[model samples]
Target: MERSRYLQVALEAAHAAAEVIRHYYRDGVEVSIKADATPVTRADVESEEVIRRAISTAFPDHGFYGEETGSHALDAEYLWLVDPIDGTRSFVRGYPFFSTQIALMHRGEIVVGVSSAPAFEQIAWAERGQGAVLDGHACRISQVHALEDAAVSSGNLRTLAGGPRWADWAQVVQRVARIRGYGDFYHYHLLAAGRIDAVLESDVNILDIAALSLIVTEAGGVFTDLDGGPVTLETTSVLAGNPRIYAAVAELMRVPG
Candidate 1:
């Protein structure tokens, strides 16, 4: 019952943020660089504000960690992680890849999540125990067990390309039946919906993928950092897939031989 309420609030917040994003997306907005050199626009800021307001109103005591608004009461028992526009670059350039992400973390474990891509007309959500849903239908992962038979996707591999894992990643790329770079919320959506078999990323923040982690996991997929660690506030990478494919990828990532 409590999880349902949290999911409802999260979905509402995501919808509110999507409205704000769509408004600016249609009217056009200026972009500015953040301290980390990433692009930000009015849609990003305003959408985050809309989401923050919606969530805070429902759970006044819960904490918030938004990409644009910064953090508030992070140590609180309940924390909402938000990325109003996860694909700011794609959004700034008039693409349809951006989305609003919202996830509730209770005691450091994500309990509810909602990912809304207004321009793409896609919304995915999940609760800890309840199944994941894309649009209005329940979603699940693919059953492809072998890397040679799996369709793989990669996202933001800048860090991995420069690190020791590049060789291992290359080997995996060579083994996969297919490879695509549907970065941001798209690949995870595909994975959860069973349209893809695996996704790899080496550069992401909790705000960007926290909601996605829960969505994929609830859909019967495994989601963790590139090192096979659980997703946390400090997570910066991803290695997610169905049970068998996930194990194969994790092993290949560790020892390409």
Candidate 2:
């Protein structure tokens, strides 16, 4: 497929998601937990239906994966990843931080990523060779080079509960310049747009980070696991940042807290 087609797929997926999600705006829909214990809602299912149908019709042979419904294992030349409503909890509460994510991976690399935050009234997207853009303006990561100087964003503390990982998380949080608990894909969007420096979170699904991993990298940031390897669907934790800030924070990661 042509590179421009990647953008087309991503954008259309985002638009489809936004249209469904808007039905819940202001006074929002109630939420129920999925089998995995993560929240799901009508908005989620509605958006996923739109996205999945579009993907199926657009590329009949392509492999598709999403959060609401799991994925099929694939080594296909083209794979499309979707997160209908990435921040379902936030969506249930009518918060604007929630978003829809769509990505295209060609031969194991993310060639295009589109993130649309309807409440935020902005779209941040990018492709493998082209640099990232936000609201149609080109953007880059901040030039900050030191851990102490970097502004950090993280997920909810509850995601770290039910384990000894909380101690490790606390230790890592204390080392950062500042910590904001803006959960979901918005944090990564901020990082990509250079408004935030780094983000670390755990217990995420492949659909949650699939598009984001590429968006960050195209914006001149690094997307990796906490240990600094490539961002993977199998990873339980993820660390993403501008390259310089990532290196500094990677070294600050706690060992056993």
Candidate 3:
């Protein structure tokens, strides 16, 4: 299939999932705690089912890895990663920052990505080498070359406080122009659109970072683990942004305080 076809599939699935999310948005959806103690909602499961059905119908041979249902057929040439509702806690609290993320990986390389903030009516999508876009407008990362000039962000502070690298957060906080709590997929969207300069976080799943990885990199930014290594399915710490901020954050994430 053509690259555009892959992107179209991802976008369509994202739109379908977004609808499921919108239906439950701020309607006091029931929530349950998963084994990891993270909140999961009816909206998350329903949205993943919607995305899974769409992908399976369009490409039955492809593999799937979803936040709610887990993975299938990892050895397949193509894999779709889905995070149905990336900020379920926020969603449950009537926050509008939650989003649905979907990405297509071909032979281990991410090729197509889509993120939809349904409550905000904002969507960002990109195909490998095709650049990123927000609501059909081209998007690019900021040119802020120095940490002092950069606006940084990270995951939910409550979770980060428990992470092994919690102390590292202080170094970044003290150095950057400012920090925002635009947790989950929202940070990546802002980075890709040049609204934010960098995002750092620990305890992330591939489904949480995969789509944002492509979108940020395609927007002329860098996306990798805090050690400056390539991000993988198992990567836990992420630092993504323009190259300058990425390198600076990587240095801050170094061991031995």
- Candidate with best lDDT: 1
| Candidate 2, 1-257: lDDT as tens digits | 13486588778878877877887766557778877778888888888888888887888888877777667646677888888888777777777878888888787777888888888888888888888888888888888887777789887545667666677666657777888877788888889888889988866767788888887888899888765567555766788888777876666664221
32-70: candidate 3 lDDT, tens digit per residue: 999989999899999999999999999999999989987
- Number of the candidate with higher lDDT, 2 or 3: 3
What TM-score does each of the candidates earn?
A: 0.97, 0.89, 0.92
lDDT of 2: 0.78
Error of 2 at 120 (Å): 1.2
User: In angstroms, how far off is 207's CA in candidate 2?
Assistant: 0.9
Q: What is the lDDT of residue 217 in candidate 2?
A: 88
RMSD of 3: 2.5
Following a full C-alpha superposition, what root-mean-square deviation does model 1 have from the true structure?
Answer: 1.8
lDDT comparing candidate 1 with the true structure: 0.91
Q: lDDT tens string, model 1, 1-257?
A: 23477888888888888778888885668889999999998888888898888888999999999999889999999999999999999998888988889999999999898999999889999999998999999999999988899999998999999999899998899999999999999999999999999999999999999999999999999999987789999999999999899889889899222
C-alpha lDDT of all candidate models, in order:
0.91, 0.78, 0.86
Worst 10 contiguous positions by lDDT, candidate 3: 248-257
Superior candidate under TM-score, 2 versus 3: 3
Please identify model 2 stretches exceeding 4 Å from their true place.
1-3, 27-30, 70-73, 156-175, 254-257
Report the C-alpha displacement of residue 157, candidate 1, in angstroms: 0.5
